[model samples]
Target: MAGPGGWWGRKSTPAKVETYTRWSFYLIALSEPLVIGVTALGQVEARLALLFMVPVVGHVALALVLVSRALDWTAGRRPQPLGLLGAVGAATAVLAVTSLVLTQHGPDGEGAETVLGAVFGTTVTYGVGMMALAMKERRRVVWLVAGYGVGAGLVASALGVPAVAALSMAAFMTAASGFIAATSCFSVWLLNAVYALDEARETRARLAVAEERLRFGRDLHDVMGRNLAVIALKSELAVQLARRDRPEAVEQMIEVQRIAQESQREVREVVRGYRRADLEAELSGARGVLRAAGIDCEVSGETDGLPAEVQSALGWVVREATTNVLRHGDAKRCTVTVRRPEGRVVLTVRNDGATAPHGSSRAGGTGLAGLRERLSDVGGTLDAGEAGDGEFRLVAEVPLTARPALEVVS
Candidate 1:
């Protein structure tokens, strides 16, 4: 079995919100029986209290079922609970009529009237509120609440209640139900907003990856497109010349070979540039991307004097760490620090979210393994793992030494 907090800790932000909202409605449904049923027992005769308890308990049960189904419908997990919604509405009407009958003939005391009034108002308020959650439009929610309030008054007046008292009941029901309706609607809205934001964050990460791929593709095309066309034309001309036994055909073929060799070198340069990361640029980008994703990212380091190879390796570390923070965990804050301690330049990135394990494959990609390979090339070391207190930390260390710069082909 999982530990005490494991169940809750495993749930995502939106799932937590959904659970909280669903249980809030459940609590309201449960409170109906505890508040109204218990009040009925103490304030009225046993038989009459039982009469009131019957409908109150029944309504609470039906409300619980409807709340689940309605929320499921709202989340698109299931079809609309049209049948359940109608049943709950019918139960609410029955509860209201029962309360009115008891108030009219079953009792003649202040306590009895108070309990019956509580039953009538509370039932209608919660019932309307619960139904409002499944409604697609605010206008329908308004109409539903108004209709119930007006219906309450009409039912009271038809049962011979005083006109002024019936009007007061209508107003009370309308205002109370309106408050509950607004609360329910707001809860649903907040839950949806949370889910939408999480999805948008994922989309942003995907878009960033796509944009980087497009950049690489464009660079490759620019490097190879012209060279490949020239090589093809030269080869075709050489073929025609060689068939005519022209001496220039040998020269043209040699030129084509040189062009092909140059193309190969250029392609390697493009790949090298694409693979290499600038430490300063990566640091700045990591901060911006994390901050845009609602993470508080703090960078406290300089990359000015680092060797190119060391910087490139550490820069990959920063990029990968930032991506993990964005895609793997629910991190709130990230801290990146670079320190040169005598012989080694140490880069550390720590985040408050620790869901992703160290060296884990990321979305079918090499993940930390790729980072490890990059760091190894520069004679650096990488360490990534949970650092306790719900934090994940990645540390890369490269020796501070002069490294030969990559030679460019002339």
Candidate 2:
């Protein structure tokens, strides 16, 4: 996944910027030890240099082993805390013993640079140890760092080194140690935070898809539920009449076929996301459904010679309004009126016995919001609100132009 266009994907602008930052951290980690190693080698003979390298290599190896677990934790891998603890303890012990040995084996007349080089070698052990301790126990880590700096200063002072020099080294090492440790810990924590956010975003996307599926299921049930029931009733009647006269059975069977065909068309419309309404079909369906539900429904309209865009937009308004009347309120009467005046086509649906919408906002349901979006694209508008005492009204208007229809069709 490290290769090009793999897990990192095609490197974006942000990723390219981070490349320099990532390299800077690595260079600092590597150069700290190298600077100390090179400075020690220049000041000492080959024999002493070899001896010096032994403890430096050992301490750094142990520190690296200890910090590897923290790296693993950042990468969302298992943290071997027990092994990390062992490595940290071993590194600290080795660095302490090495510092005491360096003090005893004073560099040919106590050269300050050589002694400081040996002391600087302890940085890796202290830095990695501090990070481990900080992650586990904050208070204890502060005291541990303080004790390490003081102990190193005491060791240098006991070797009869200058008081001022020992104190300076102690302060310098302490600051350097804290800087490396804090940087490493913070970098890992930031990466982990980014990973968590990505997971949360993916989870939300999945939940949204699930919500859409549930919405589609509800709409399908609403559309086909009554139609299927009517088909069942008609088929039963057709079977009974077939036993007596064939012509009556034939008529009932034809009605069942028509209902089934309409249901299939409605299902297709819901699935394809191209659900433009037909004025005649919507008007016919709404009247039939409303009357069957025992509500006195009256529709007044001149739907002839209208542009396709106007018909599609207003047809959706009629259909949604009728659906709301059936599903939402307890109504005795509903009126649908369509008029074309002054180059505007207006369709109004108003009903008595209006109840509060099932949800908070009027456009909370997908149907109304979708209708509004559809209307907007075709230079049209929609408004739904309480009209008067115990009544709600929905009004939709569209420009009478063939341009919108062309745009919608294309």
Against the true structure, what is each candidate's TM-score? Answer: 0.90, 0.54
List residue ranges in candidate 1 displaced over 4 A: 45-51, 107-112, 354-366, 401-410
Each model's lDDT comes to: 0.84, 0.66
- Using TM-score, give the best candidate's number: 1
Question: Per-residue CA lDDT of candidate 1, range 46-158, in tens?
Answer: 88777767878888888898889888887789998888889988889888888888888866898889889889888999999988888879999999999999999999999
* Backbone clashes counted, model 2: 0
Per-residue accuracy of model 2 over 311-408 as CA lDDT, tens digit each? 87788788778766765555689898988888888888888744434441355567678788878878888888667676778888888873454322
lDDT for model 2, please: 0.66
Q: Against the correct fold, how does model 1 do in TM-score?
A: 0.90
Top-lDDT candidate index:
1
